[model samples]
Target: MSSSSQEPQLPVIAVVGPTGSGKSDLGVNLALALNGEVINADALQFYRGMDIGTAKITVEERKGVPHHLLDTMDVTQEASVADFQKDCRAAILDIHSRGKRAILVGGSGLYVRAALDVLEFPGTDPKLRKQLEEECESKGLAPLRARLEELDPVSAARLGDARRVIRALEVHGLTGRPFSSFMPQREYFQPALQIGLEVDREQLRERLALRVHGMVDAGLREEVRGLDAIGLRRGKTASRALGYAQFLRVLDGGMSADAAVEETIVATRQFARRQLTWFRGDPRITWIDWQDPELVPKAVQAVNAASPASA
Candidate 1:
């Protein structure tokens, strides 16, 4: 470490929050003010044809801010957290090399965490994945959870939930080691400054509802139709995006558009709540009250505090 009092320069500035929390707008504004380039952290935004549903910022919307990591993946391709971390690191370094700040903007907390932290996951074993998939079809996730509990209680404890438990167990079955052991205790690699966006539950719900309706009006169904025509299936991650999943139900005649939109609003609100839960636990974050009257000034302060002294 340097003896000087100045802070170390870091590659990225991540602006993260839940959907419709004004993250995109704030990121764009901050980039304009700070001489930064935007790099998207949202998973769904990587799909090329997913526009209105993913709430992807267009060129006009980005206001020529030079956004990266958006529209970089094919809709059918699997884009994992590891892949995103590597890609984002490169993008951040590229921005820094260009003498510009890297602003990471999105609501995907897992993606943001993976990008900023040094994550370690178990080694991949395709045969094990296949076997686990077969077993999931045969017995269920419960049996896998039990196996994981027997093999590695520490990992099981950390991954108590169904989704994580299954994944952890699968990895253990493959690698013959606990998955949690792979998690890196990464030090703060960046002088990161986090800004959490906020809105009232009711207002957010209203916004989500309106946004879903607007997406439908903006040809979301047609977008899905196009993806389907291009062979993007329901099992793919892109197809499971909030609006896409709900609209797929609509397409299948399982639910009406109105009902789907209502369900989507509920789901999105729950997602926002979960995001808030995750972000609130991080002490490193300095929350900016976007709901407050002096949001701009507070945002500016956040930027200044986040910037390296040389900037």
Candidate 2:
């Protein structure tokens, strides 16, 4: 007796958590169990040749489950949330058309939100951005940041760093709207079930530190050196990636590998804290202990019991 319009909207299965929490593995498992494909939501994974630092899954580890959106960009190209939203939705639609589920995976907060929530991106003006950057350089960030404070206090408070502040100013200049006004609503753009991996704080800390050391031992410095030769320094997004930045200093002879290792570990831990805070603020996500031995079976159960999505 129900109309077609009342049918459940297609669902997106998202696995999200702090870094080093096994999101990628869970994603692969969920995809295989559900006859699905994973669509990476991690921003850093988009760049090609960023394997070592990103801890990207090897081909063999993927178990032949097709992953979309990884290695889609050169190191030099900027990662854009807007572009990701468009591309992720397209991937979801394409997968659904084939009667396959789409598993969204990553810990990138805003990027994950962009792919799931109702968010509007303000248009950008390159000239205005350049003007703002020039002003920041010539006049210093204080005046421009102060200007943004007056025009968009919300965004001014939330945004940090020169690049972000300037981008906020540029957004206001172009749209005549505060950048914060475009914040994502919690409403889902389609049916979705978010799975969060919960881990012990101390345990995760140890894991992250060991993980960094493993990357270093796996030739992270060599990776950085090769990437630097290829102009990684000119890559805004890739250049600033977690471990890559610390190692860049090592390559510059300004730091020792040991020093960079410690610094990268600290920075990565901080980044993980920030990620945890961001994802924890959303009540829509269902959390599971990362150590659960029955994780895959429970995830499959969640998907099956979820009231959204057809086949």
Winning model by TM-score: 2
Candidate 2 lowest-lDDT run of ten: 1-10
For candidate 1, the lDDT comes to 0.79
What's the C-alpha lDDT at position 273 in model 2? 97
Please report the candidate that would top lDDT against the real structure: 2
- In the range 1-311, model 1's lDDT, one tens digit per residue, is 25333656754677876788889988998788879999999988998898988888878988989999999887788779888888888988888777788889988887888888767556576776777778877897788777887898988767766667767877777777788776754445455667777667778778877888888889988888788777567437987788788877777889888887788778877888898888777776667756777876688787776665763
Q: Write the per-residue lDDT of candidate 2 for residues 205-270, one digit (tens) a residue.
A: 999999999999999999999888888999999999999999999888999999999999999999
In Å, residue 52's CA in model 1 sits off its true spot by 0.8
Model 2 local distance difference test score: 0.93
What local lDDT does model 2 show for residue 9? Answer: 62
